[model samples]
Target: MERTLSSELNTQQVSSKSAMPLRLLANLLQWQRRMASRHQLARLDSRLLADAGISEAQRFSELNKPFWR
Candidate 1:
């Protein structure tokens, strides 16, 4: 019974360890997507920005932000 418990704990630890890299990858992907969207937002014309209900000030704010934010 004690050996079984130890093996289970070890398995849990291994799984959690493996999850760290996946989490980092997910975060990086999200940041990359944010960067791309910001780039597109920067290219928007006044008409398109008005259609999207975004003001020039809002677009400027978003464009100036860091990708990680």
Candidate 2:
């Protein structure tokens, strides 16, 4: 048995359509991680920031960013 050109195209189209929601979910999860990391940064004390080699100014800049950014 052999596949026809139309069947191949249909298979590709179905695969592409199904991937869209997965990509969206991955993007949303990435955004959530960024937001949580920023919140954690905001909670860090000066000593912990120093230990991590992050300056207060740098921490402020990252923590101040909008989650969407």
TM-score of each: 0.86, 0.87
Every model's Cα RMSD, please? 1.9, 1.3
List model 2 lDDT by residue over 1-69, tens digit each. Answer: 799999999999999999999999998998999999998888899999999999989988898888778
Q: Whole-model lDDT, candidate 2?
A: 0.92
Report the Cα lDDT for residue 49, model 1. Answer: 96
In candidate 2 the C-alpha lDDT for residue 22 amounts to 100
For candidate 1, write residues 1-69 as lDDT tens digits.
Answer: 457888999999999999999999999999999999999998899999999999999998999898999
Residue 65 of model 2: what lDDT? 84
Which 10 consecutive positions of candidate 2 have the poorest summed lDDT?
Answer: 60-69
Q: lDDT of all the models against the reference? A: 0.95, 0.92
In candidate 1, stretches whose alpha carbon ends up further than 4 angstroms from where it belongs are 1-3
User: Which residue segments of model 2 deviate by more than 4 Å?
Assistant: none
